[model samples]
Target: MSVSPEAIRSALLARREIALIDVRQEALFALGHPLFAAQIPLQRIALEAPWRIPRQNTPIVVYDDGEGLAEPALHQLRALGYTQADVLEGGLAGWKAAGYELFEDVNSYSKAFGELVEHRRHTPSLPAPDVLALIEEKADIAILDARRFDEYATMSIPGGRSVPGAELVLRAPVAAPDPDTTIIVNCAGRTRSIIGTQSLINAGLPNRIFALRNGTIGWTLAGQALETGRQESVEKGEGSGHDLARERARDVAYRAGVRRIDSADLKGLIADSDRTLYRFDVRQPADFAAGHPAGFRNAPGGQLVQETDHFAPVRGARIVLVDDLGSRADMTASWLAQLGWEVLVLADAFDGPLETGDDGAPPPRGPHGRYKRPYEGTDNREAAMQAYLDWEYGLVAQLERDGTHGFFVI
Candidate 1:
């Protein structure tokens, strides 16, 4: 069966559940695609589809930009028992011909939502020079690197400590205990910094907080130096501040419309086989590997927020997060809800020795056709980095014109 672009657009407009799959390599797919079109790449359909689109009868429309991969994808999906699979009539060309917007780059919607957060909430930030001056002056400041630990170790601001996005709420209190200390959050680029900085503000932190404006890209363009092989991490305290952190994060999540549910509620969600559901343990990998509730996959909350489209390509699926500390899940769920997913923090205080082993990392789809992001490497053209920042600044307007992303900043 073939579905029209108009029909796909209508489904999104009405908030109906649909999976818009783009069966092309990540490199080709990243050139441009519909805001909600997930790149499954033809070879990954069998590997990623069953987990990504869990509902066997979920309405799915696969497309390609004249690569002729969509029809084969439809066949593969049907063979795997996806009853409601169909091909997008006219493929990517058809969607464009229908006068719809195509977003560039991966994680487009989440990044756009980050831009919207800055636009609406006026999230505060400091330029690279000011931050550099603070470090040189030895000012009372705490620079928190909000990327993954390995990313922090690779290259980061001087004196910056690794505190990935979701950990900010739980660990910031310990990182900067004094109310007088200034706090700055930085990521390789903008989204996580904006979200991390704003997350603290939303959680009612007394310490002054700012995002490292434009993140490391901005720092590099400003002719500033970065510290490499810095293994410093934010101290996870001995339960002194967790209750307060939990209280604050819960307030933030409540403001962002994230729900807290018990084991009984989880059972209800699991029984609803008609709808797609994802269960995750949003904690540090080590903590998860130590012990975690059975049946929940490890998805470090920080990265999950950054890569939601890849992790949960079924856009409308419900997500349930469990963390030993409820605050982590609440903070994570808050961002997910704002990004337009139905999300809840699973709050069951389970008692027992839980599952432990290697967190089943998702099968790696090889990097054969991965899109090379401009901000990744140490040596990027200044113009490309600046252009990327410029593109992000205009995303709020683009989001308005597209009108499909139901994102709101809290």
Candidate 2:
């Protein structure tokens, strides 16, 4: 049976329990999707539905761009024990025809919530020019790229170390042991930067922590130089090879008792949730945009670990992560378990299965969008820069006030 857009809207309005999934590529989903519509592409429906919906009996509605994708997608869902699966009567086109609102943009709700966080929390940040000057002067400031190693390798602020998302929680303190040295976080854009910087401040690190006002994207547009080379890991073990990195990360995960789930286990998880379940494709944004499981949110693993509080918010919520390679998720879930989260790495859920460390192929770099930070533009925007800083400063206290973080920093 097909479900009408109004029916979906009414259910959401009433806060009724249902799982609404948009089976489109991340790029298309980013363009527009219904509020609360978690995206998982059609090709990945069978693997993701159970893990994300976590309630086989919950109403599962899948929609596509009025193309013929939904029917086959629904069939896949039913085959996976999503017995309540149905398609939107006319797909995305029908939702629009019903005059219902559609949300657009990446992390749309999270971005709005981030803005709200800025308003309520009064976070603080360093203006891009000031940060750039620090780099030029050979100052004591440490610039850490809070993106994947590959993304960092593609391009990064000169002298920046690839700390990644989860590693920040483990290594930030070690990066700047002195309270006086500045700690800066950057990604291609704002979300990860904000989340990464705040994670440290929230963890009660005594250092002066700040997110690059925008990120490398902002830096690039300002005509600043980005050095492209191998992603240099600051904290090295016996050796810097992939095997050593994987072993070190696995040790951490095992110490935290992070569990790995197979396809059938995931199917049962989909049968268990009474509340909303979020499955995140914790890979780089561009990788997520290419394709991912249906119902998966595009939260790069590192950022997901760094900003667990802001992203998930729901205490005791079950989260499943999908990665094109196992190491990133494994590394992330380890820290998440220590932070007191119930996280699982869904091995088979990912389409075009992730490379094991054994694959020996280097990680791929993604297209870095050109986004200029407000402070760097011609306006100078002193008020905006200061306001940005003020917002970040407050997150430390917010994390304290809401103490049931349910995060385990592995």
TM-score of each: 0.97, 0.61
Task: List ranges where model 1 is wrong by over 4 Å.
Answer: none
The lDDT per prediction is 0.88, 0.64
- How does model 2 score by TM-score? 0.61
Q: Write the per-residue lDDT of candidate 1 for residues 187-306, one digit (tens) a residue.
A: 988999999999999999999999999999999999998888999998777575888889998998899898889888888999997888889998888898888998788888888988
Give candidate 2 regions above 4 Å deviation.
6-17, 44-55, 97-99, 236-317, 320-410
Report clash pairs, candidate 1: none
lDDT of 2 by residue, 209-258 (tens): 88887676567556676678756766622223334344555555566687
**Model 1 score (lDDT):** 0.88
